[model samples]
Target: MTKADLIESVYLKTGFSKKESAEIVELVFDLIKTTLEKGEKIKIAGFGNFVVKEKDSRRGRNPQTGDEIEISSRRILTFKPSQVLKGAINDSNA
Candidate 1:
């Protein structure tokens, strides 16, 4: 869901003011971003792990022009869902 939807849901569930809920959501996201910037990982029990991964520079083809190009390496954020979360999703789908 979108950020607004998440904020609304949190507000409803916790009986918090809209502004308060929004701040909380923003803070959580900011914390995650700051932590990731430090090249660290975040793990939420029964949810998932957030990590930053390094990518090596590589050659790539331009789709439109079919020209060779050099792709610069960069760090990317990734998430791997925890086993508990996977099981929960599987059970729900079942």
Candidate 2:
């Protein structure tokens, strides 16, 4: 779902004002962003883990020109869902 959808859900569940729900959603996102920027990981029980991983510069080929290019080093964010979450998803599908 989109951010607006999430905000609405929170507002409905908590009986918070629209403005308050928006702020709450935005604050949660901002916290996640800031934590990732610090190269830290967040683990939410029965949900998932958010981690930042660093990759070294590497050589890559350009698909268009078939030229070798240097790929700059970068930090990437990854999410790994917890076993409980996985089970819930699988059960729903089944």
The digit string of per-residue lDDT tens for model 1 on 1-94 reads 9999999999999999999999999999999889999999999999999999999999999999999999999999999999999999999998
Number of the top lDDT candidate: 2
Candidate 2 at 9: error in angstroms? Answer: 0.5
For residue 27, give model 1's deviation from the true position in Å: 0.6
Model 2's lDDT to the true fold? 0.98
Clashing pairs in 1: none
lDDT of 1: 0.97
Per-residue lDDT of model 2, residues 1-94, tens digit only: 9999999999999999999999999999999999999999999999999999999999999999999999999999999999999999999999
TM-score of each: 0.92, 0.96
The clash number for model 1 is: 0
lDDT (CA) per prediction: 0.97, 0.98
Quote the RMSD, in angstroms, for model 1.
Answer: 1.1
Clashing pairs in 2: none
Instruction: Give the least accurate 10-residue stretch of model 1, judged by summed lDDT.
Output: 28-37
